[model samples]
Target: MSLAGNRATMQSGIGMIEVLVAIVIMVFAMFALISMQIVALRYQKTAHLRSMASQFSADLADRMRGNIRGAHDGAYNLSRQRYPALGDPAPSCPGPGSCTSQELAAKDIHEWRTGLGNAMVGGWGEIAGSVADGFTVKVYFLDMLAAADGATPVARNCQPTAADPVLHREVSCYAAVVSP
Candidate 1:
């Protein structure tokens, strides 16, 4: 055979091998893109949850500010274990019948807790400290990704302590110190 024909024979399967290599590379790229998409979706959900917690915290702050007297009287103080029943006592002062500071506080807490429960999974709130020391409003909820074992790293990481209600669990906390 001529030298040119010999060269063509040697190069016969090179194009097929190159095409296979390209296909393999493309497959890997596609898998990487899919992985990135999954991570984006997870982060999006986390952001949405954090936003809800922030909104709830602000709402409670606004409520306390609206009733400064009750807030000052330590009426909004709630323990981490305390979960006000949903729709309890109907969070209302009623027409012309004014409610006391404590009553109003209870109403506000009930309404707020109800909203939290409705908006989140295993959602709860804790009002620690007092008006004199500045109240710390904390919202807690279960996030599968936010395990205390360091499965997922993010903001508001819930560290398990001897004082924690649930030790070594996937709990996410959003806290705000409200003077009102």
Candidate 2:
């Protein structure tokens, strides 16, 4: 071929190579964008769960403050082990002073527990200490990523000791302290 023709052919081949490189870089950039979106969605879900937990703790604290007598009597103390039976009938308190302090506490707890369970996945709760010495309210929910391993979810006690399941299980907890 002539000199001009040979140079034209080489230039066309180089242009094609550059186009291919640009296309490959664009594909990699698209994949990176998709990965970042997925990570942002996961973090958003986690933040939502944490917000729900904070609301639940605040709710129970308000309930305790409303029933200071029950709170001081230790009637509000609860644990995962003492879950109220779902079938048990709620106490009747249509009028003021219709129920005793303990009865009111029972009713409050049943309502609180039901609401917590309905709002979160695999949710559970506990109340420790008493109004006399201040109190702690804790709400727990399943850890979505950790539970993907297909193991049974367990409730965690924020107060941990040796052999505590909180160390091994897929659970998350939120706790708040309030003095009545």
Candidate 3:
């Protein structure tokens, strides 16, 4: 019963609800992408910190091996509390002025500690095992990668205990134990 002109006047178009739904879906997708990016960055930082810790420990161990006498004489044994300062000198042996294994070891410690401080955030190294029974250099760092609770482990001898769950906030501390 309607005329041809009247039928042509009814236009086909998108509804408001459909547009809103599309916008909501796009917003969710964007949020998910952002979340994934954040997690990936966190894990990447953790891996980097781990790599630095292992490499530093290995370097110290190699230095220790080069001076077996110093290793045995407790020259390379550094306690948790006392560390080599930045201004410490490291002299080489078998050159113009001969240096003892002890002097070489001192240089190694100073350089190693300086590297640790430079490479990591609040990074530090300690000797867990004694020279007689071999040695384990435990590298400690404030793991900024993970979101921690309230009471993180402080740097101490044989510290960062064997506990898994972190009780501290701000930062979760991690320790990499490397043997020499």
Clashes of 3: 6
Which pairs clash (backbone N, Cα, C closer than 3 Å) in model 3? 149-168, 149-169, 150-168, 150-169, 151-168, 152-168
Best by TM-score: 1
If scored against the real structure, what TM-score would every candidate get?
0.79, 0.78, 0.73
Assess each prediction's global lDDT (C-alpha) against the native.
0.72, 0.72, 0.65
lDDT of 3 by residue, 17-42 (tens): 99999999999999999999998988
Highest-lDDT candidate: 1
Residues 3-78 of candidate 1 have per-residue lDDT tens digits of 8766755754458879999999999999999999988987787788889998998999899998888898888875
Model 3 bad stretches (over 4 Å): 2-11, 80-97, 147-158, 161-180
Report per-prediction Cα RMSD to one decimal: 3.7, 4.1, 4.6
Report the number of clashing residue pairs per model.
0, 0, 6
Output the worst ten-in-a-row residue range by lDDT, candidate 2: 155-164
Model 3, residue 2: distance off in Å is 4.7
Order by TM-score, highest first: 1, 2, 3
Winner by TM-score between candidate 2 and candidate 1: 1
